[model samples]
Target: MASSGQFAIVTGASTGIGLELARCCADEGFDLLIAADEPEIERAAASLRADGAKVEAVQADLSTSEGVEKLYAAAKGRPVDALLANAGRGLGHAFLDQDLADIRRLINTNVMGTVELIHKVGNQMRSRNAGRILITGSIAGFTPGSFQAVYNASKSFLNSFSFALREELKDTKITVTCLMPGATETDFFRRADMMDTKVGTEKKDDAGDVARQGFQAMMDGESDVVTGMKNKLQTTIANVMPAETLAKQHRKMAEPGTAKD
Candidate 1:
C-alpha cells in the first residue's frame, strides 16, 4: 500500500487510459479524486472503491473554467501527491469541415482546461515542494494531423508544454512527465468520429500497458515516455523526417475513407 494520507487526482477517469491510471494509483494505495464529464464517473469510483482505495468521483465538463473549478474544489484543500492530467477530447475530419463549436470545445478541453488545472495544482505542489505530474500527450503530436488537425495541435502544445514545465521545476521536487501514446484501444477513435479512417481501424496498443508505462515513468521522474515500441520508433523517425512528408503520411492514415481502401 502507498503511504497513508497520500492523495492523487486523475482527470478523465471515467474510461480509457484515464481509468487505468486511476486504478494503478489506487493499487499503490493512494486515495483518489477522479473526474470525467459523464455520469460514468460515479461507476468508475464505485469500482475503484471495491479495490479498497478511497475514491471520490466528480462529473464535470473540463472544457470550461467553471467545470475545472468544480473538480479542483473536490480536492478540499488536500495536498495532491500525484496528478494525472489526462482529460482530452478528439475531433477528426478536415479542419474547415468540422463544427466551429467542436473546435472551440476541443481547444478548451485539451489546451486551456488542462493547462489551467496544472497551473492551479502545480502551484500548490510547488509551495509544498513535492509532487508528480503525468500528462497524456500523443505521438500524433509529432506529425501534422491532416484529418485530426485540432486534436494533434492541442497535443503538440501539451508535448511542448510538459517539457518546458519540467525544466522550470528542475530544482524543485515536482516532476512533470509526458506520456505519448500512439493509437490505443480506447473509445477515442469512435468519439472523435474517425472510425472510418485507416488509423482508427488499425491495431492499437492496450490501455493497461500504456497506463503502466506512464505510471512507472512518472514515479521514476522520467521527462517523457512513448508507450509502445512501435510508437517509440515512430517518434524517432518523425524527428528526422521532413514536416511535409510526415503530414502526407498522416493524411493517408487519417483522411476519411482511407480505412475502406
Candidate 2:
C-alpha cells in the first residue's frame, strides 16, 4: 500500500500524459491531488484510489481564475512535496479565424492558470525550502506554429517562464524541471481539433514513455529536457535554423489549409 503522507498535486490528470504522470507518481508511492475539467476526473481518481494511492479529485475549468483558485483552496495548508502544473489546452485554425473567447481561455489556462497555481504552491515550497516542480512544455514552443499559432505561443510562454523561474529559484532546493514533449499519442490532438494535421496523424511517442522520461528527469533535477532523440534533434535544428525556414516547415505540418485536405 502507498503511504499517505507525501503528496504531489497534478492538474489535467483526467487523461493523456497527465494521467500517466499521476500513475507514475503513484507507483513511486506519492499520494496525489489530481484535477481535470471533465466528469471523467472522478473516474480517474477512483481508479487511482483503487490502486491504493490516497487521491483527491478536483473538477475545475482551469481556464479561469476561479478555477485556479479552487484548486489552490483544495491544496492550501497542505505541505505539497511536489507539484505538476500540467493543465493546458490547444487551439487550432488560422489566427484571424480563431474565436476571441477561446483564445482568451487558452491564455488563461495555459499561461495564467499555471502561473497562479505555481505562485501559490511554489511559495509554500519555497518557504519550506524543499520541493520539486515539473512543468509540462512542448516541442511546439520551439518554433512558429501555423494552425496551432496560439497553442504554440502559449507553450513558448511556458518554456521561457520555466527557464526564468529556474534561475529565480536557483539558490533554493526547490528544483523546477520543464518537460518538453513532441507529438505524443494523447487526447490533446482531438481536443485541439487537429486530428487531420501531421502532428495529429503521425506515429508519436507513447504517453507512458514520455511521462517516465519526464518523471526521471524531474527526480534527477534536470532544468529542461526534450523527451526523445528525434525531438532533441528537432530542438537543435530549431535553434540554429532561420526563423523563416522553421516557420515554413512548421506551416506544412500545422497549417490547416496548407497541409493535405
Candidate 3:
C-alpha cells in the first residue's frame, strides 16, 4: 500500500477502466485527483471517497489543451506520485465514412491530449527524480485496424511513445508503464459505434480485471503489460502475421454489420 499522503492522478475516471484504476489507487491509500469530460466523474469520485482517501474530481474535456490544463490546475500544485493517462476516444468505421470533426476529436483526445499531459507531468516527475506513470495503450496497436483506423493508429503512437519514454527514464526513479488491454467490457464499443461488429459482440475481459492488471503492473514499475492471456496471444500473433493478413483479419471483426447472432 502506498503512504496515505501519496498523490495520484487518473484521467478518464468517469467510467470503465479509468474509474477502476482510480479505485485501485484509492484502495492502496493514495489521495486522488481524477478527471473526465462528463458529470459522472463527480459520482465516481464520491464512490472512491468511500475507500478513505481524499478524492478530487474534475470534469474537463481532455481533447483540448485548455481542458488538459484545467485538470492539471485542479491538482493544486501537488507533486503527483502516480499518473494514469487513461483518457481516450475511439471511432469505428471506414476511414472515409468518419466525419472530419469526429476524426479530429479522436486524434486530439487519444494522441495530442495524452501526449501533452504526459509531457507536462513527465517533466515534473523527471525534475523531482520520482514518480510513476501509466499509459493506457491497447493491443489493437499491434495490428492494422480496418474499420477503427484512426483509433488504432493513435494507440499505436501511444504504444511506441510509452516504450521510448520508459527507456529514456530508465536511469531515473520515474517509471513509465503502458497498459495494453484488448476488448474490455466497457462503454467503449457502444461509444465507438462498434456495437454491431463481431469484436464488439465478443466476450471481453472485465473492466475491473483489466484495471487490476494495469494498476499492479504500474505499482511494480513494469515497463508494459498486456492484460488477459487471450490478448497476450493475439499480440504475439499480430507481430508475426503479415500486415495485409492482419488487416484482413481485423476487417472480419470490425467491419460494419458483422455483429453476431
Q: Of the candidates shown, which would achieve the greatest lDDT relative to the real structure?
A: 1
lDDT of 3 by residue, 1-261 (tens): 344889999999999999999989988999999999999999999988765668999999999999999999998888999999999999999999999999999999999999999999989898899999999999999988999999999999999999999999899999999999999999999999999999999998999999999999999999999998999999999999999999999999999899999
Worst 10 residues of 1 by lDDT: 1-10
Indicate the TM-score of model 2: 0.96
Assess each prediction's global lDDT (C-alpha) against the native: 0.95, 0.89, 0.94
Clash count for each candidate, listed in order shown? 0, 0, 0
lDDT tens readout by residue for model 2, 120-208 = 89999988999999999998899988778899989999999999999999999999999999999889988888777777777889999
Answer with 1 or 3, whichever has the higher lDDT. 1
Scored by Cα lDDT, where does model 1 land? 0.95
All candidates: CA RMSD (Å):
1.1, 1.4, 1.2
TM-score of 1: 0.98
Q: C-alpha displacement of 14 in model 2, angstroms?
A: 0.3
- True-structure lDDT of candidate 2: 0.89
| Better structure of 1 and 2 per lDDT | 1
